[model samples]
Target: MTDDLLLTGARVLDPGGGRSGRYDVAVRGGRIAAVGADLPHRDARHVVDLRGKLLTPGLVDLHTHVYAGATYWGIHPDPVAWYSGVTTWVDAGSAGAYSIEAFRRAIRDFRVRVPVLLNISAVGLTGRTGESRDLENCDVDLAVATVADNRDLVAGIKVRVDRETVGRHGTEPLRRGVEVAAACGLPVMVHIGTTPPRLADVLALLRPGDIVTHCASAIAAAADGGGPVSPALREAHAAGVLLDIGHGSGGFAFDVLEAQLAAGLTPYSVSSDLHARCLYGPAFDLPTTMAKLLAVGLTLDEVVAAATVRPARALRLPDGIGTLTPGAPADLAVFTVEDGPFELVDAHRQRRYAPRRLVNDATYVAGRLLPPRLPEPPRPWIPLTAAQRQALQRRAGTVRALLTAPLVGPEGLAEQFPRQQAAVPLDPAAAVREPVADPVSEEG
Candidate 1:
């Protein structure tokens, strides 16, 4: 194929500059040749019209599981990546030291850019059981050796810190993981859920550049007393800890996310923790997760930054990978922002209607056009099973009584649902303040 290709008449969205306007982007020798209005058509060997579409840098999903044949939770990367406008997919702790070689062998032929976070546990996500439950699986020396051996492929270390995964180990596993990360000179991506170590303790062990995935989880007794954004979380963010939306099954809660957004604790990166269970619903793909964020309150530019530029920076990938500037890699995605009365559901099954949602139109990787996948029929919300419905009915009875009682305003909200009120911003601008220095520049 010829090296020259041109995309004309599209609204180019540059999240880095916070700008969007009609322009043409030229590609040659697998890099952006030029981006401007009305470049001479004669300079291009081939051209495609993208009228009425939005073009931006190809997306990067920092947290995903694409070790496919090697791990239990793995899913193939290409189907979810290129088709959904993602050119780079970072596998989050799907394969540990023991299985990483096999994982590497399996993905040798894949076209998408795949970097991995080595799991702290040697076995990784081998089975249904938690990788860290045994503690012995967390072999630090072995992890260091593996990272040293696979420097090019391994971006960081990953550890899941939760009640089910780490159990009574509390913060011990996290400390061990952090040690290994320090030894290898890499960052650690910690998965947070219902905690025994408590979110504060986990944050304490983490250095400035480390990542906290699933920051919006709504399981019982969250870090900030079940509030959307906790004071400790704000402190962690201020201290330079990066938060990610690892929207996995049971990870994202609409109520929790809304409160966090309102409080100004926006995520540093947006990723779909796309695994076997979540790939079909809730967290369908990176674009779907981006759409959910847009539905909540983020502008299109903000959402694109979370998916593209921010992720590339967080992963410490080369600078040009997530930008559309001249001489950068010609990885681009086109999307259509459709008006919607669309029902968007979170991990908790709480539903919201969005007036607009983003849909993928086309994708280009390395200046080569990739075939688009047929759109999956929309399945907004999963059907509630009988047992779940029955339980909800019981809870509804309790809520019904409260609703019938005299309604109070803000005080009543704070009294009945203190977590939500606690998440509300006291100073809206301060709550949503940007970090003083770029968190992406810090070393692990």
Candidate 2:
């Protein structure tokens, strides 16, 4: 008897259909066999009722750094996957040629499905900023050799040319990185924040199928308070270059993003640069980031597509890791349509506070259901531990001070309504300082 499970009475939210309704889905041999209102359960194994929950396809986080031990920026992937319901994640340039094997044998081999983008820098992002300046580390031959050696695990190449980071090497390093990746016939994923030469110049190097992450990020001269995305960006997009939202710590700029969105530029894929420094706040998890987009005018279907099928297509994963269609892996996520007052931020220091945030209920991967735990009850008012007492005293003092003080201007309040603050006079000088400026265009 084949062991199987049935999930029924749930409102399925399918990206392909963009609709929600009661449905039944069946899982057998770690794959979804059927989905509808009534699925046969004769000679079955187990059945679970899913009432009042929204069922969606399992999420795929495309731009993550899961180097584990190779780099400080790398993080263990399983916790983010199982806990957060991400079944497929693409490691956005964590390890280089020298250290990729260890990553494959120790990490990728153990996990289910985690493809990697080999960093163009031969040594990868080790130590700190200038570590990339070491010429030997960025050996093109070594990177090509490594990618050729591990064709099964490596997806493409990654390069960073941030202004404060890559320094003088600039376009030369990027050109070399592309050369190695081109030899291997894989797309290149470039991290654009502080790179030299210029954003337009770097963007000009990317060809169709190649990826440009942090398209709305506040890069070297691409800061929100700067200027507009160079004509090169528009041309690249027109030429089929995929733009990814690598919403990491210093990647997404709210101001630049607003401008880009208003300019009619939309991202092809939405991904979180999920890592230690980024996973906590604005980029809590892929789902949260998707919810933020939903708040920012992306339809539910558009948001889901960017995070799932669109990314799966970009990665060229023919097995179909994005949809919930029959014969696909039984990966799914269940959430509640929560009404919440939430706050979101971008690479720029701007904040978007919304009245709602998606709250996860349960997640399923390969027929295994992992439900989120209920929040723990507050501790009884007992003698506090040293750490707890210190926290409580600080909170108490802050609250008492707030209570005693008179309500001043809107600036004094933590979360004041927009109407409370007086608008500042528009300044022509500020316009000149728009963070994101005209990026370098190989043309000029």
Candidate 3:
């Protein structure tokens, strides 16, 4: 209830400084007052026990579409933010000069910190194909003016270099995006997938601080046919081009990611390209994307750094936003690492079982304590119509026979019938339920 609060007994992990230990963090007037084990909570009006939780800087998602009701692929930020341990949502090219005012209006009352990347295209992502196909839409002067007008909210420029988005324009759109970013003295975050100008060409044009998102996309061609970790990419990384994992529905591929990691090409930041389509499956949330990285051999500390400190530095966000340092804003995420047989999926539909997953326990924004978004309570099975029940029984019987049949080993089970294995309930009666409407289908 009070602005001053004390979080005690948390395993404090500040990946920014490579510090990890149990500490008591005190907050007052929305800023961190002190952080140490012996800090007295006598002056604090509110005290929270975080004994079993890991407390780190508030998570930062560098790539997201939070312009809900404004963009077709956008979703509200708060629901995905607090729930996934993110306190900062960086809108990645969801709004351009045309819609940025609406985007700004939408987030004016939001609790989460929203910094936007102004799209190069004047229309942004309002169309079915994308915002950059027409050369007319790539208005450099308007974009530069927009960034100047909204200096506080605008972080950088965003451009998609994929073939489908840019069409015959090739790297011209990227050129315009870079020009606007240069004029505004900001970094440019380029999205690369199916490339006509090639990923190497995109990389060559980017400056040191510029970011190439979806670096692990399988659609990206290797510069020298060596592997997915192209020679140009390695050179670009050396020259300071930041590589970001914008794991959207079609961006991340397990094979490509594994190869890149194996070849020592670790991403500078990890972000869920959280839009409508990928929000449910594959790219579930920022935490899930981090879990996928964990599954692929990134250390817990490494993964935390990618989601926190690294992204903050990349976006040039104000200090104290991504660290639990004393005198910083009291934005924190408390999580518990659950031991698991947890199944994680990539954008390519490849599955990997992680030994552990970080589950958010609670979050604190500014100095306000917020509840973690909990899973919905299981609904009671709705009684099915007689015909529907009979159909379900028959379906269950067929599945049971297939699961028990010879040649359906563990490998075959996962490979051959992935969807059926995950979908079927053990009890046939439980399977005969009414379909629930998708929560995200309708506009807010």
Candidate 4:
């Protein structure tokens, strides 16, 4: 242990301390051997002076995808995690019983620290539209068997119970999902949105330690046409169920988040839900996602807790990750807080307020900074003719239609149609867009 690495002059933020201090940390054999001032540097093999940087426990993104080509919907976890200051990332149901082994062979066995959440469905989100709905693929015995086989790597059970996937048998799938998870003595992570048997009924079935993701989603309108996070959410939280914010392409809702936050019901943890579909904007990576929550009243410590300790606990890897305790794995992140007018987006293709920029300066796993990855290539800024630009502007009036276009769905579209003009004031506002009679009605 004499030939160790020394990282000095860092503003270390220890969650356990609930305070930060300037200190040095020593790493030997992939474990943090010490943290103090004047650590012996004579026998050190490497010394990195991280001055003017904030050092914290490596980010732990509890919700992500890593199956690569297997799950066409997601990017490789190692590239996404390491490049964005996340050392540990849980693959949230990109594979299941049938494909879990292959996933391990291709992903988990690698040097990267990526864990998996076995999907309740065997194939695990196979085809985008309705593959998760096939009851045959969601065999309970099979899922349990898979978990038992890979208990060391399988954190919990994941099931998407949205309207498009679960249809009328929403509760049934969730019940079976719980049963399967119970067989392995593991918790179930249920994705709640848009289906039958309301949010309350579904949440009522969850127990302590079980996870409810997408809790703050604008799906499954209430009797009053509101989002989930209903009275049942309060009941479930009181009972110790964890509310995980899986802010995916279609799950994050500003109104729901604000309502819940105002009601003193913040998410227990925040997850990237990093998939190919939504990675373009709003949900680029985990740090950006965390910054979004940090914008809306959460302290830096509180936001860090959501990405670290809370998520680690939810994954049942509390000891292995989410902290910088002595002898713990040397997973760490360095970040810089930049000022002013930072933009954050939600899953609803909506923008929100952010005052500080949470930029990932660097990331390390077991004391080794993974190779830097290049930033994504900027989109081609097509120089449209004046006529074309005018046409695009005209098309902007039909926002609903433009939103349906494949390219316009992501944040990139906003660049094409900048909000330059303010609408004129109206007496009551309802008279601004008066409804015109149909051609047939007018003729009559």
Candidate 5:
């Protein structure tokens, strides 16, 4: 039997390992076997020619909401992963101690890897906001126990400190979440926006390894919504806090990103805060989000690192997560670099253009190519323009027509069962014989 799958002739880019250039990758037994020049494909079961394509580690989204069916923000990752090249979907704060078992049950069916930053609020994001309003829901001891119970799934703790989510409670929720993190020895991922607790106050609570998910959010940029970045944000960047682009429906803006970039405060990771609301526009997918960084003048290598290696290291996801190195899981993405003065938009509809973008050609998880899946329509609560709604309806219609239509014309199909072998004799009365049924011999 053939033992390997060889992929050749791609501009291999492994930003995590600092390896880039013309390279061929080999996969054997669902793990990367080798990566170098002239890999022999003679004995490989499958060999794909990937000339003029860009190959990199399967993307790891540091922030996303994938606890589908149970959470207000949840959207299944598999539907997007097959087409978007995101292999690791980090479900950020979609579930908490109260709903973790259900979250686990939901994720059990996912094809991609899903690690969670359990929410500080026991209710999780079952609603759009107010999860942290009730202080009783923010029980620290219970959270620590929940993490203990689900140690393998829980990577860190998440707290949403905002006007709507925390109400008058302010950063008290953030403090409790920090306590939980301190006990668990896990980093806290704080969602910063809509200050009652100022952005400065929020940044102050975060330690070196903790993360600020929507660091480029216009909602928290400054009081006036545009200008120089606050000194607090600069201090946090200097103090080693990781800035992640959680480009959700309302979580990002070009002005803020540009300001941060100009201030030498590059995002440590790039993640599509993909959910029911943002899945369609603004934050379509991780690659699109990466392209926005490119539009902002970041090199492909830097953007790739932010999407892959940097996030993987920040989260300490398993060793092989964001690389194509030998012995790592053979999870990878292949893309065609398309020339495009592509119109890009941030969470607020701020516009920019990218000269080139990565269009996904294939996504593989553990050496097996993932099958296509269409995403569901937006949830009822999600606000969309009439044009956007029309587009979705049109898309649904097209998909329905495509699926309902015959897969091929007569010329495109071949018959597997021929008439000659299955035909009954015309002169059955004259020469009919019964065939024996076997049950080791004849049925008794």
Candidate 6:
């Protein structure tokens, strides 16, 4: 009969619905009850003052690898999701038919939403590359059956079409991936990388509504590196192929993206492609990747749509996953939209400045606020710079000290017992402690 939660006095932004204003959002039973100035109840079980904050639909990252512990690229989303405001993480090509069951089991414990793009190769992205090199693993029938059985989980198909992944096999893996998607009546997402099969051949196999991740990849678009956009890319953009900025460690380039924008080709979705390696620096999280788009001249509305509704449209996600419309999933993100000449970096290490930025303050999934989660240390195979290694060590040390030290001194404690000798200890020796230099916090 009453709302479960009421968030009042904030700038509500629903790019998918093209609605933006200072409005109150109500949540009930883990779904958005209403989004307007007035509600049925004057109060709720819990009310939060969201004054001066920007509230929007929880971000939907279209490309990520959250199949942790089993694959090389996988990284759990919760560690970053809570702080980054991403509720939906699309695990693109992280698992395939052979590993789909295992992948399902692995993700069962994740706190955030994980929609999958079944890899064409049965082995999936278990290693760095070459998942599709063995054509036997690229079985279309198996992939189709896998999708059919798990229709709700499998968003579409994903194939990494590159020289290293396909080896001498060329475009066969991509063709097979397309076949599986076609049979299942789903769009296929193709990852473009190093040459040998040529970007043109890869693009030729794709149909409209299909996604081309890493569209501005430096390696994949190397031929048009500093120059204008290529004819093949131009034609694909004209033909309705959706472009996604899969900003992985080596997949994004400021120059390339800039060129694309100049040529009137804006990315349909902005994704971090967050994996184990890039999670620390380049593609830190979806918000950071979205910031890169902001730096590259996209307005806040456009960037929000790219990170939310547009990606949802690309995947055809259900349950109003990307909007704050009434009756939609009560997934929300609140941000402190800060004034900035903020410096943001791309995968190529190039920098740009933006006039304003959205820094997350809180993330909510299903109307429940997400608690903080510490990220696991990088895998032994993950390469880190000297500075990064030292930073990790310092962070660990700080956390250790913070948790290991006594929470309160005797002076701050109260007597818990009323028995004789329940008096607090005030001995000068026990109360007096050696002076230690305060450790200057290194975190910003």
* Number of the top-ranking candidate, with lDDT as the measure: 5
Candidate 1: worst-modelled 10 consecutive residues by lDDT: 373-382
Per-residue error for 55 in candidate 6, Å, reads 0.6
TM-score, structure 3 vs. true: 0.82
Q: RMSD to native for every prediction?
A: 23.5, 23.3, 16.3, 21.2, 4.0, 10.6
Write candidate 6's Cα lDDT for 13-45 as tens digits.
Answer: 899867899888999999998888855446588
Task: Give candidate 3's error at residue 168 in angstroms.
Answer: 0.8
Better of 2 and 5 by lDDT: 5
Once superposed on the true structure, which residue ranges of model 5 sit more than 4 Å away at CA?
224-228, 422-444
lDDT digits (tens) for residues 1-444 of candidate 3: 343888899898888756799888889888888888767767788888888889988999999987766666777767666667899889999888998898888989778899999999989887545678889989888888899899999999999887789988889999999999889889999998775777778888999999999888876744324468878899999999998999987788878888888888889999999877666556879999999988888888999999999999898898568888777788889899898868888877789877788898877789776653322211123223476457657766886687687965576655554555555447776678887788788554
Task: Encode model 4's per-residue lDDT on 1-444: one tens digit a residue.
Answer: 584688888888767435478888888888788888778888689998888888888888888876766665656666565668888878888887888878888874444677788888887865664546668877888887888889788988888777777765667777888898777778888887665657777887788999988777776434314444466778989898988788877777777788889988889999888876656655779888887887787787788888877788787785558777778788888878777667777877677777775677778889888774433322233223476457546645576465566864476555566678778787776777778779998888
Off by over 4 Å in 1: 1-3, 17-19, 220-226, 372-444
Instruction: Indicate which candidate wins on TM-score.
Output: 5
Per-residue error (Å), model 4, residue 33: 1.1
TM-score, prediction 4? 0.81
**Per-candidate TM-score against the hidden true structure:** 0.81, 0.78, 0.82, 0.81, 0.93, 0.91
* Ranking of all candidate structures by their lDDT, best first: 5, 6, 3, 1, 4, 2
Model 2 spans > 4 angstroms off: 1-3, 16-21, 108-112, 220-226, 370-444
Error of 5 at 377 (Å): 2.6
Encode model 2's per-residue lDDT on 1-444: one tens digit a residue. 443988888888776434457888888888887888877767358887788777777777879977755576666666566556677788877788777878887663434468888887767766445545666678888888898889888888888767655677777677877898789888888877764567777878888988988887766434422465667777888899998888877777666666677777788888999876665445768877776676677776687788777887787765557777888788887777666556777655577754555566666778887543322222232223476557657766886798788879777767646657987888989888858655586447
Enumerate residue pairs that collide in model 5: none
Better of 3 and 6 by lDDT: 6
Q: Which 10-residue span in candidate 4 carries the lowest summed lDDT?
A: 374-383
